[model samples]
Target: MSEKTGTFLVTHADEGSAVFRDVSDGQVHTMASNPDVAEQDVLEATIRPQPPMEVAWEVVEVAERREIELVDTDLSPTTQAMEIAAEQEVGDVERVERAGEGEVHVLSVPPETTEDAAADVLDDEGTIERAARLGAVRVEVRREEDDGVLNVRYLPD
Candidate 1:
């Protein structure tokens, strides 16, 4: 079946990282915004839409969404890795950090958490695949065959 797909405008502001507002809901949140924006959801559900001249409302494509925060979402792969590595002495760690002011999750964490000496463990499962598992956080999947280019942005909380 074809994946449900729609377009989203990457919003950027000096106040914080970019945010992906629902093209239909007029919902706005930080790039690190959670799927459940208690505050914004309330507004979108209760408050009516108004004319903004340039735009009227926004909504995100539900099917294509793989949970990726852009700009500066909080991400913590390192801290998690530290925790996991503590259990295993040998493992590879690549990316870990806060995903802005949103929730916490272990993105691209190595099999080992704390005491790993390698970075490749970050993608034992691969780049985008690992990122896809992270749902709702921004991840750049690059050619796994080469080293460099892959990136994950999690805003600091």
Candidate 2:
């Protein structure tokens, strides 16, 4: 009987149903019917628990919905990001905010594990969640071939 309104990230979508994770609180809501939203979409909506079990939720109204684009580029990390990576040990991740908006995340990893690390970041739901929280529209992943440093930039456009 209660409704919640906030930004949500679509984590899963199939033929008939979809799963959304609340951007603010990380609560998982399973919708009985797909709301025409796809995975990785950020939605601003009001939702109420379904009848009977109330274990599921339904989207009563959608104020806004957008897909956050992901781009993987061959570009190298920024000079500042490289400097931060140089100062940190392997397996360290540093988050730096942009002057205008969004954030740049610098990750230091072993050269042998660089590819795996980048792949992991690209595949993580947390990445999209962070972008949604920051109101970013796109995520760019940059890394040098065989390098130990990677950069994930959340950008608004």
Candidate 3:
């Protein structure tokens, strides 16, 4: 989908949505905006056109949005690793910390845990799948395949 940004002049509100006039060309558009918007208040929003999930083309995310701004900041590598590791770790993940290059996360599980056992545990917990879908961190549950050892390597995203 593509994004469209504009100023909205609210005209009416109903059922958690709003009818607004796009100030750019005086065209009327209905979107899900703030219900409390005054009749003439102008609102900045980011809208994406969704191609007919069940109906015709529609716009969404019209409540509150602002122009994009870029900022510069430096965050600790360990902190970043920990956050991603935590998000991906299931109940068996005993420890998560930053490691050296090539593999950024070091995870410690129970002494008795094997790679297959860890994989089974993670499967039951379902957090690893979620982490994979989120794509926030790259990780592996085993260090060496032949050794049958369970470990986690965080691949930075």
Candidate 4:
């Protein structure tokens, strides 16, 4: 068979190989992949049929890759909002105060924001960038019941 180009959704990936499903044909193909490839990643690749089965395929080159990251909602509503805001644009975040070593608390979020809505704005690229710069990998959202004060704490992984 000849070479084909299509987008593949990675169903499984490990140090040795990866399994991807063609977005166009719903066909699953396993190929030798870089260990960095991960599940749930969408990859655009050049493929060729393998052996006797036309359904079997191998990747020639990866043209593109995309991944959707899910954010945890264990934090308080306001902190979640600020976390998303920070991810969207760290420059837009203000009143970031240091809580401890590798820890920071953000105090600028309004009291009325909902957690689910805030979680929607989170993306891996921004989160990773912010985490690397701040030297932390965990975020905690806290709210004071009496005064209605909201604080976002960034902590180590």
Candidate 5:
């Protein structure tokens, strides 16, 4: 598969509609105009300006397990994270290391047979119950890895 993956940019303003000249060869797309949207909805963004403005983006991408990198991932490896989360029998996430600018929350997941526990943890809605639910039979509940080390579960099926 191509190293390039599709991205879903969700922002008040369609900031990704345009890109810098150097990076514009790819990774650029047209924006859909929305008139119903209030000025505040799209503050001073790449698209439009608001009365008082501030803009930001939330980009998302989906990739297969083989396409994922262990340490450099934007999100946790749900498969592994969940397995680790479930095994510890605890629910508390702590930042293990800084991933890019965002930190990595080494959540513990049950040792069930879910494909990607780590990814689930990273995509979590910041709710333990929700994260846990994603874990097939096992939940991606964050637990401690002894001392102050926060990790995922390690329970066996």
Candidate 6:
């Protein structure tokens, strides 16, 4: 069988098996065995259908693997992000694509919970999954010190 090569994100992994999602496309691949990969990991790999059934895939070669870095910055949200936050209600989120690559996410939360919300975003696996989908290498989280606004910037290398 022919092999497919692309960037993939490890969407789920456990002791027995793992699931990968193509970054460029939304195709899903399931592997029968754990490939020493963890959830939220980004990988450049070649995969081929398993023999017989061909319902599952196997990683033939892995060219690269990486983890998205999450950073907590003391910097406040950008002017554009602040403006978007102002127009949103508490508990709302807005996503804006960057001019080049990646994305900027504006979140509005309670002023008293801004820090907690920021921390939650930084710790969420979905944040890394989003970065992988956007081909981003890092995520920078910025929060307003006294306001109810936060900016999560997914940056490309």
Model 4 Cα displacement at 154 (Å)?
A: 28
Model 1's lDDT to the true fold?
Answer: 0.32
- TM-score winner between 2 and 4, please give it: 2
lDDT by residue for model 6 (95-152), tens: 9999999999999999999999989999886788789878899999999957789999
Query: What shift in Å separates residue 140 of candidate 5 from its native position after superposition?
Result: 16
lDDT of 3 at 98: 43
In model 4, the worst 10-residue window by lDDT is 116-125
The per-model lDDT (C-alpha) reads 0.32, 0.89, 0.44, 0.55, 0.30, 0.91
Per-residue lDDT tens digits of candidate 1, residues 28-77? 43433233332211111121122344222323333343333233212333
**lDDT for position 112 in model 2:** 87
Q: Please give, for residues 1-157, the per-residue lDDT of candidate 2 as tens digits.
A: 6999999999999989999999999999999889898988899999999999898889999998888888888888889888888899988889999989999999988898888888888888898899999999999988854669999999997
Name the weakest run of 10 consecutive residues (lDDT summed) in model 3: 66-75
Off by over 4 Å in 2: 145-147
How well does model 5 score by local distance difference test? 0.30
Q: Taking the tens digit of each residue's C-alpha lDDT, what string does model 3 give over 1-157?
A: 4666766555566666666655556656665444455443445665554456422223454565222111111222244444554455443343443454333333434335545554563443233332322232444544333322344443444
Best by lDDT: 6
Residue 87 error for model 4, in Å?
Answer: 35
Q: Which residue pairs come into collision in candidate 4?
A: none
Q: Candidate 3: where are CA atoms >4 Å away?
A: 32-38, 53-157
Model 2: per-residue Cα lDDT at residue 36: 92
Q: Backbone clashes per model, in order?
A: 43, 0, 1, 0, 41, 0
Error of 1 at 148 (Å): 18
